[model samples]
Target: MARNKYDVDEVLEDKFDVNQLKRLLAYLIPYRKRFVSVGFMMLSASAFTMLIPQFFQKVMDVCIPNKDMKGIAFYSFLTLLAAFYSAFSLRYKIKYTNQIGQQIIHDMRYDIFEHLQELPFSYYDDRPHGKIQVRVVNYVNSISDLLSNGILNTITDLCNLVFIIVFMLILNVRLTLVCLCGLPILAIVIVVIKKKQRTAWQVQSNKQSNLNAYIAESINGIRVTQSFVREDVNSGIFNNLSGSYRKSWMRAVMFNFTMGPSIDIISIITTAAIYVLGVSWMINGETGITVGVLVAFTAYIGRFWAPINTLAGFYNSLLTAISYLERIFETIDEPVVVKDREDAVEMPPIHGDVAFDHVTFSYEPGVPILKDVSFHANQGQSFAVVGPTGAGKTTLVNLLSRFYNVDSGRILIDGIDIAGVTIRSLRKQMGVMMQDSFIFSGTIMDNIRYGNFSATDEEVIRAAKTVCAHDFIMEMENGYQTQVNERGSRLSAGQRQLISFARALLADPKILILDEATSSIDTETEIILQKGLNELLKGRTSFIIAHRLSTIKNSSCIMYVDKGTILEKGTHDELMAQKGEYYKLYMSQYASLM
Candidate 1:
């Protein structure tokens, strides 16, 4: 319920969903045989435990009375064997349960990650990355024990409870009924606290997620926080989120602790009632009662309540796990908004004739990003799109690559609608270089080869040479094999861009779209990159967006876009001659240099 600068907690479910547990259990269905074996092992252990109390009762009633040493030794040996077998059963039970549990965790995490890969940019756009990560990691781990051991243990405990009840009835019907008196009272405690406990845990989960989001956000922006001296402010916010999580955890556990003691109180009161009544009845010369029966029945009382307490603890865990299950399943259920449509075929080899026909689109309804935008670019032609910030230049390129579906109208490549083909096939022949210039952690060679997996080391180096990245890379001791971390943190901005450029070109795409790709590079590198582009653009369709005049002056066509519309379009010389918006932007840059 708390909000901070970095994140807001997700909404809590108003009611417990039975289907979530059913679905969680469905994951175990594949290994039901293993779990079934666990159940039998657990039952056998309980049986052994039940028989121990019987041995004690026999010694007290018959063996001791007769002073029979052989009988005592026989029962003593049987008890040892029973304890040994019970321990053995439990050890194997734990082993199989853990193996099965880990596998289920692996499956759940894998499913969530695979689903995440298919999810669209919009899905990530709406939620914090840290929140999504918690569901995949922390939330899944929280329920691992429950899925692997808790359900089967609960079932086995219930069976143990039933067996104890049957043996109690066989001993004395009246005392059995007295024990039953505690059931309605214990059920009342559970019914009262179940909803409150579940709601508390749900809030706890949300708070933890919020705290994780802020922590992740802070770590990613720690440099900015330090540079701006916002560490104290950020730490204060973290403390508040951490405090909220602590409070919610305390509240949830308060309810969880309530269940165990309530069962204990009921058990103690019921046992005392049996003892008082049994003593008074024997004094009154009851024919059906005996000392051995009383001792055995009391031992059974201990056995009876043991499982009840275990069941109560299991119930508390179930409530806590249900909260996590809600989020994990919610993510898995997210729609893949940008996935390939049914009946989609592979796109034919591209010759790079791209067209947009009245391609109006919006990220949100009623607020268009690109309004009735239409254009045609023939194969081997380069177009320069100049636009002010938020003028839909980036969105235009995103739509061209089918990162999102257009709201209305169609975008065509080689006279075929892109939506008619599989997304993988459509994007395979096109290269996209965005402003970020992300570089993964690896040898420089591996990072360049990422977009084009089949490119040999020689080809990778060739692409690097074209983008003028080869010089700096070769200067390093390892040349192309030099290690670089994520985002190329060890490299300069210009070097990172050059490496990214090489990566894009290595794909040998027929249609290349570069959105502010050269913005990070220095003038010297940009000039060299321009020379490479002249040769590369000879047979490929290219859309280049940049603010520098040198980057776009030689383009076959220049488009000046503002407020989601193209204000002017022509060759650089023609737009300059027209003295339009493009002329004003160019003059301003020229004046700034002066």
Candidate 2:
């Protein structure tokens, strides 16, 4: 429920984070050479284009007037050659820049995914999965164009603008001066639009994230919605989110669209003024401005404003991308709280000697899930943790596996501090089967083999049989090869649990954890499952968290936990004789059955 965020754009941080953009530059460092080369190519192409006006001036002012056909033909041929090379050079520039963008996206996505894998369970506990999913997929895709052509184009155009201005000044400074006057009006418009455009886009990005969160949540809970006949209500909520996103997008684009037209209109007005003023000056025989020079000057004016238009477009893209980059970099910047230390060492083969020395932990600060919980399980011991829901039964086993670091204490395996050992090595020797059995979309055999990739087919089948999964599996047409999607929707709850149990067994871990692993399985199946688990659990320190006292009666020690502390601990008969919390819990279940 905490992960379900239904609100749309509830809290919008309108300010742009420049640090995120600076951090993103690190991804470009590796391909800086390619980007530089692309810029160089674009600049070279612009240089050839700048020559076209000179070609025009020569024909209008000298070649045509002298009636020299050879000179006219030569300039015409040169212009054609320059145009062809300009077009050819631009092709490679576009090709290589986009390729670099794709590579950066791949690297960034991989880093986010890798970090997500290492993040603590608490990271996922606080945020909707859709919010996280958008950053890795949609948000990364949104910034690719900004990285691809935006930077190179912005830089190349400015350089080209400068090159064009120098030529314009050489032809006629009076007209060039007229063109410079437009820059002030364009600057004012940009200053007016920049803040509004950025703020709008940030809001748009928030609405988009909210919409995706609701969509993912809806899809995941569609069955429940249909069962409760709440489809209409759900659709209404979705429509609201979709409408909010659309409105924000329209608002953002309105500001972004203003940039290009404003530049274009200012450019044309500036051009007209120059032409009119130049003609009058020439008509009055003042300033010595010629017809050929006037024609070339107007052409240079077009070249100059073209880059300003490009810059306007680039600024728009930069603002949009910065909105997305904030989310993307935010994910990359997330800390991995439970991770291996720099000096951590790989754990040797586990002999199942696990000890919790006054371990205290909490998913949230100031509220403990397990307070000062200390226990020792020698090799081959089975410890059953029984408690009311939310009383830290599952948390005990979660700590044993170091899924979350202890807030105030340490956990040890065979006298080695778990925090000092590499997490991959520590977990490799442990098998955990939780209440939720997440089956990825794949063949059943592949799903089981996920526990241990090197496991052979024979080993996989044997593990499946140990949990009574092989029979139902064989009943299917494809048996072991049957395709089961994520969460194993095609399989019944018990069948999915059996496969997950088999996956744990396939890992052949020294320490086994079963937290309500049999809750969905029927009593008959559980009896058979227990029989196999009893033998497989031999010489392995196993922690079983079950409400059904019948399953844990044989545990070496049964701890009755409540309110983050153990209320009772002993064998079933010992606790029943003591008539403690464990006895009361067992009797209540017995009374219900009777």
Candidate 3:
């Protein structure tokens, strides 16, 4: 069976990956002062906590026994003072850590999103949106606690355990040794359980990614599902995915819960053994063990186990976070495959001459989409490409726009190799209107202004008028201010096409490309738009791809393409005189219309 998109690598290392942690810390360097302040606060809080038992021991042994009420009050006041200091330290620590963590998240998210924009179209073509979305939004959120509180909590817990150990030894060496006996057993239990915990968490993460990917894909294609009456089928698939997620999460939770009980049992047995040994020693008059000393030892023992349990929980969280951290780094580390050359310069204003000198290209190796294709268009000429489906019509426009580089040969503009010019400068001079007129979620006015950010409202209105969209705009409830849903689902296909046409016109580029531009427009609207389009194309180099026989009948030049090869190139009358592929196609379509 083929592996699914959500199958996360099962054998990824579960240890505390030092490199990942180091890279994550690089995001913290900007807030180093705040982070250091948080560390100092944590240390102060731990110190206060460690001192509490000492004060309690003094009260029991010296103050209460002797009925020294003044001493009792003084020591009690000290304890309260330590607690207040601890609280003060904690308040600043939390405030600083939260500020630092939130800033890091903001910077990291911004970097990821900006890098995504720099990546080429092929990157998006090869991956599912949901998988990328999860990495950007969900996986990034998983590390918030690990960054803000996890480090400080771990350090404080370790310090508390050490202080408890030292105090236990001072109060009574024999009892301390009994309590320490559980250390080796506890280590064994943690080592065994943590591996299982990490594995379970990794599986859980994969399951969650799968669920997210499914939901996003289904929602986008809901119309197809409803059309086919496959709602039941989709629900079944979703149930299976959700079920797997539940199972994986439960397995991880069980492993997490198992650690606490296992440690508790060992703790109880160690406490019982200490009591037995200490009581016997006191009775024999061999070991000088006082009641107050035993009380203090008991208190230290509880304190020691508290941190140990807390550390165990932290270890589990660290395990889960490590899995998520690796996922985040994978995306951040992806190489920018398409980048400008170091010495690339801005392209000068175009004179509208474009030439392809034996250009050959392919989306994948060993399968060419354009085979040694060569063409040229002079300034102010309307060049039309007419071909069957998959004849590389759209690919020609993509190459002109440098959406993808040619596999071999050169594409030149005004005798300059396009590859030597800066991409932004080259693309800024061309206006493209693709067959799929994708409209963003915004008002109709905003959508039209997207092509030229600096275009004024007057320019937008004029552009809409040129495309004959002004009539429909006034008929709408809000005129130009009407809201468009995502993908323009609320508008008809022809309206979306007209909006896109207006966008392209607003740019006022020297080169204009219309790839099946009038495909969605009704016959009447196409006639109106074409009259304005002809006037607009008078002084601009234009590339038109259309299947309708009459659409390109009067072009300056026409190329009939098939199987990535141009079979005929001529004017309409010249091509009809030759009686070749173009003539046959034109005559067949004309007969159908008649």
Report every candidate's CA lDDT.
Answer: 0.88, 0.88, 0.85
Ranking, lDDT, top scorer first = 1, 2, 3
TM-score of each: 0.96, 0.97, 0.92
lDDT value for model 1: 0.88
Residues 1-594, candidate 1, lDDT per residue (tens digit)? 112334576864334468777888889989999988889988988877787767877898889999988999999999999889888998998899999999999999999999998887767777777888899999999998897788888999999998899889888999999999999999999999988998899999989998888888888788799999998999899999999999999999999999888998999999999999988887898876778889999999998999889888888888899899888888787778898879899999999999999988888889998998899999999988997889999888999998888999999999999988999998889999999889999999999998988989999999998888899999998998899987788998888888889999999999999888788888877888888878777899999988877788989898898888888999999999999899899998897676
Write one digit per residue (lDDT tens) for candidate 2, span 1-594. Answer: 133465935343333466677778888999999888888888888898898888889899898899989998999999898888888878998789889989988998899899898888878887888888988999889988888888888899999989998998888887888999999999999898888998899889889999999999999998999999999998999899999999999999999889888888998899999989999999999765888888988898888998889888888998998888777766766778888899999999999888889988888779888889888888999999998999999888888788888898889899999999999998999999999988999999999999899999999999999888999999998999999877889999999899999999999999999999888999999899889988878889999999888888899998889999988888889999999888788889998777
* Better-scoring candidate (TM-score), 1 or 2: 2
Candidate 2: 10-residue stretch with minimal lDDT: 8-17
Which whole-number lDDT from 0 to 100 does residue 575 have in model 2? Answer: 95
